[model samples]
Structures are given as C-alpha cells and as structure tokens.
Target: MLFGKKKDKVHFNPGNRDDGSHEQEIDKDYVEEEVNKIEEDDVEVVLNNEENIDKKFSGNNTLSKYVELGRIMISMLKDVKNGNYKNIPWFTIATIVMALLYVLNPMDIVPDFIPGLGYIDDVAVLTMGVGWIESDLHRYLDWRMENDMGI
Candidate 1:
C-alpha cells in the first residue's frame, strides 16, 4: 500500500510572525455559483433515474407528494392567516424557505431517478421542517390565542 504524505495544519499569527502568509479568500458569490451548478447536475441525475420515477407515498405518487406538500403549505399559510404560529415569524419564514428548497431539490433520496433515494433528500428536509414546526408549536398556539378582527 502506498502511504500518502501528510499536510501540516495551518497556523496563523497576527504579530511577530515569520514566513508571513495569508489565507486565500474565495469569493462568496463564486462559491454560491459553483454550488448551484453542482445541484443542477444532481437534479438531472435524479430526473433520469427510471427506477425512482414511480414510487408512491400516501394516496399519491412521488410527484404527487411534492404537489400535496405545496397544498399543505397553502393550508399552513391559512393557519398563519388565522394566526396560528405567532411570535415566531422568523421561524415560520425560515421553515417555509427550507420547505421550498427541499421541494426544489431534484436530487433526493434514492435519487428519484434511481428508484429509491430520489425523493429522500426532499423528504429529509420536510421532516426537519416538520420537527421544527412541532417544537415551535407553542408560538403558533399563542397566535391562535386571540383574534384581533379589528382589522
């Protein structure tokens, strides 16, 4: 077996330092662009997975799951309109964004194109939002505590 050479850990010092060196900075925008590029490829791979194209969840199929989730999100919005999740507007908004991101993630568990892992990632993100929703239930319940129909 060939042994690989180990790299030394980076050391940084602000003053009294020899061999003055600075970390190369990567542009945040460039990094984000690269990440988006990779995700797009992942989406293509997921879309091409034949085995993952027909999986079923609940009373609907995988594609249906995404649509159903969208409907549920609308219902959640109605709940918000009625004032269910209060005092946690940021949390609700973040949760909504995460949910949307998950829905938009084409490469998921079993690789939807692969037959099993295709929808896994989306499901995982959804599960996380659900858990957060549950933990933040009190905030929502508080919102439901009163109706200021004076508007």
Candidate 2:
C-alpha cells in the first residue's frame, strides 16, 4: 500500500510446445493494450512535448545525445506521415510512435524531473528501440538521401 498499486504479472514460455511439453516460465509484468486505443490527441501532445524536452536537455552535454536521437525519430515520423517515404511497414511506424510516446511520457520507470538520472531510462528505451529498427531506419535514411529528400 505504501508503494502504490502492484503491477499485474504475466508469464511466457518461449520453449513451450503445442503438445504441452515442460518449459521454463519467463515472469515479467505485462501491460495490455492496442495502438488503436491511443488517441490522436495524445500523439500530438507527445510531439509538442518533444521540443520542450529537447530544450531542457540542450544545456546538458550527455543528455544531448538522447535528445538528438529523439529529434531524428520525430523527423522520420513526419516524413512517413507526409508520404515523403514509402515501403515502411505499419508495425515499424507503430513502434516508433510508441517509443516517442514513451520518451515524452512523464510517468515512466523513472520520473523525468529528477535532474541527472531521470533520462537514463528514456535513453535506454530509445537505444533499444533504435537497435530494434536500426535496419529499417537505415533503409529510410538511404532512401531519403537517394531521393534528395534529406535536403
């Protein structure tokens, strides 16, 4: 009661077979939802907040890297939405949008207001996300340069 509501626990058995074979359970907290449930207004709010978050970190040398990554992702989001780029899968866009929302979200694993440590988690999330879609992002960048869209 002191720490707040407990998170719902979810489990997965990666090695489990359809025939009900023995397997190890992976225990992790899970959040259930669909992207369609996220409102357009929330997306816009996250987009707008990006600028403020950037300004907050601009003065910090280390946090600047995280801020720049956020900018690049936002730019890609814009290009994708404007139809300036194509061949990108919907799930990729969804994942990027979700990451954007996560970075801008104030209530995360660590609160964003805590001077030095707050953004570590944000950066980690962004880093993992970038790693996850690095190939897609590279393809986008190559396409942008080839088509003169980067200019």
In terms of lDDT, model 2 sits at 0.57
What tens digits encode model 2's per-residue C-alpha lDDT throughout 1-151? 2112122322222233333311112111121132223444554565677677567557679777767767776777677656676666554555466567767677787798887877766665565556546788888778878877642
Collision pairs in model 2:
none
Off by over 4 Å in 2: 1-42
Where in model 1 is the C-alpha error above 4 Å? 1-70, 78-88, 108-111, 135-151
Structural similarity to truth (TM-score) of each candidate: 0.39, 0.66
* Cα RMSD for candidates in order: 17.4, 10.6
Determine the C-alpha RMSD for candidate 1 after optimal superposition of all C-alphas: 17.4
